[model samples]
Target: MKKTVKLTVNGTTYERDVEPRTLLVHFLRDELGLTGTHIGCDTSQCGACTVSVNGQSLKSCTAFAVQLQGAEVMTIEGLAKEGELHPIQQGFWEMHGLQCGYCTPGMIMQSVQLLDRNPNPTEEEIRRGIEGNLCRCTGYQNIVKSIQWAAQHKNQGQTEIPEASAPKVDPQPIAPVP
Candidate 1:
């Protein structure tokens, strides 16, 4: 039987009919075209399919689409704003956190959730938080650095800003240069 379900994903809402047995990962990747979440291991041991559901890190592959009728889901695609990259993504890039890039999206999603719970996680906490996420490349040294960078970066947000932001082009078109 097909079940009608609503999904609030990445600040957007969508309602559709789906099979009760449809996994959340399938719904996200296939239905919504969110291919950022991957299915590395079908057994759910790998965290490659990780996503934030109602602010909690979960294995998307193991979750049923119908189970998330009213939950707010955050995926890798939701982290960045407009054209700017999220701090975690910046950290990953600056710190060289990825090697193969196959596990990056999941790693980033997990890191965001981890930092949310413990904004100042220690090295051990960082390790434990990402234990479920296995990366065949980089050996996790750079990944830890990336998370640490994000933790500190988030902590810095607590302070007040002087001008709010740097100067940038406005949404409206600029006068054509002569």
Candidate 2:
């Protein structure tokens, strides 16, 4: 049997009939065409399918579309407003937080939630906050820096690129643009 769900995504309301078994990730990606939410593992381990449901970042792959009835959802597509990038998005871009970019959307979503809770998260807190999300290409240093950048610049109303720390990983380093 199909169930009808009302979702408010990115400030837009959408009503659709969907299978009860349909995952929220698929409902957003396949149904609503919000491809920014990626399905890296589909088992919720990779954290690539993260989305904001009622202002909390969770794995969409594990959530049923029907469970989100009347819920306000925010995907990566919803982060920007009026063609301008959200501070988090700008942080990622300026901090070189991503490479290959498969895990970026989820990372940003999770980071935003973290910042919402703790605007001035320490480096360790930022690390602990994003421990759920994984990025294969970029070492976590830049990702942490990105979140830090977002946290620092979130309410400042100014944009400034910060100097990146050396990657803690050995051998291969993902260099950022100077």
Candidate 3:
């Protein structure tokens, strides 16, 4: 049996009928077409599926979609506005916080809550804040720097990085390593 779930995501309200067992991560990615919420570990260990649920950071894979009735969810896509990047997104871009980019969305989502709680978190505090999110690419040095950058620039509101000044990324499909 399918249950109807209504929730507001990224300032948009959506109502859909989904299976009772559908995970929120799957609901977001599969149904809502919000693929920014990645699914790395189904056991909720990796924190790759983290999203903001009613102002709290939560691992989307751990919660069923039906469990979030009338919830306000914020995915990575929600961070930006009016073609401007959120401070954390800008930080990640400027600080070289991501390498593979697989974990970037979740890391950014978690960092959003972290900065919300403590806008000017210390280096050690930033380390502790994102401890749950595991990044196999960068050793977290740049990630920490990225969060610090956001903390410093957060009060400025949406940051508009000029196109010429921003780094140019040529995304090519990765060929599997034998």
Candidate 4:
């Protein structure tokens, strides 16, 4: 049976019918079309599906949509405002915090909570804060720089960074060798 779940996401209220077993990650991606939250490991180890629930960082895969009937959820899409990137997001962009970009959304969301609790976290503290999130690329050095950038620039408003244009490549058939 599909149960109706009403919740606020990214400052918008939405009510949808969902199966009892539907994970919040699936609900966000499949139902709501919020695909920024990636699914790495469903076993709750990757932390790729992290989201903010009621002001706390949560792994969306660990909870059912129905369990959070009236919760306030914030996904990566909510990090920007008025067409400007949030401090953490700006940090990631400027500091090259991501390589594959699969783990970025969760990392940013988790960092939100970390900075909330400790605005000026030490390098070790930042490392401990994001221990739950795993990144296969970048060796975590740049990710740490990203978070540190946010910590330093949290109070300043950042303009949106324009997306870099990708170089166009045209494939040409190889000449036959005689």
What is the C-alpha local distance difference test score of each model? 0.85, 0.87, 0.89, 0.89
Q: Rank candidates by TM-score, best first.
A: 3, 2, 4, 1
Tens digits of per-residue lDDT for model 1 on 4-91? 9997999999898999999999999999999999989888888999999999999998889999999999999999877667878877
- What are the per-residue Cα lDDT tens digits for candidate 3 across 83-135? 88888999898878999998899999999999999988988889899988999
Distance from true position, residue 167, model 4, in Å? 20
Off by over 4 Å in 2: 159-178
Candidate 4 displacement at residue 40 in angstroms = 0.5
* Local accuracy of candidate 4 as per-residue lDDT tens digits, 1-178: 9999999999999999999999999999999999999999889998999999999999999999999999999999999988888989888877788999999999999999999999999988999999999999878877887898888778444454445511222255433322
Candidate 4, residue 74: the lDDT equals 99
Cα displacement (Å) at residue 12, model 4 = 1.0
Point out where model 4 deviates above 4 Å.
156-178
Q: What is the C-alpha RMSD of each candidate to the true structure, in Å?
A: 11.2, 5.0, 6.4, 9.5
Q: Per-residue alpha-carbon lDDT of model 2 for 2-93, expressed as tens digits?
A: 88999899899999999999999999999999999999987779899999999999999999999999999999999987787888998888
**Worst 10-residue lDDT window, candidate 1:** 160-169
Query: Any residue pairs clashing in model 4, and if so which?
Result: none
Whichever of 1 and 3 has more TM-score, that candidate is 3
After superposition, which runs of candidate 1 have C-alpha atoms over 4 Å from their true positions? 158-178
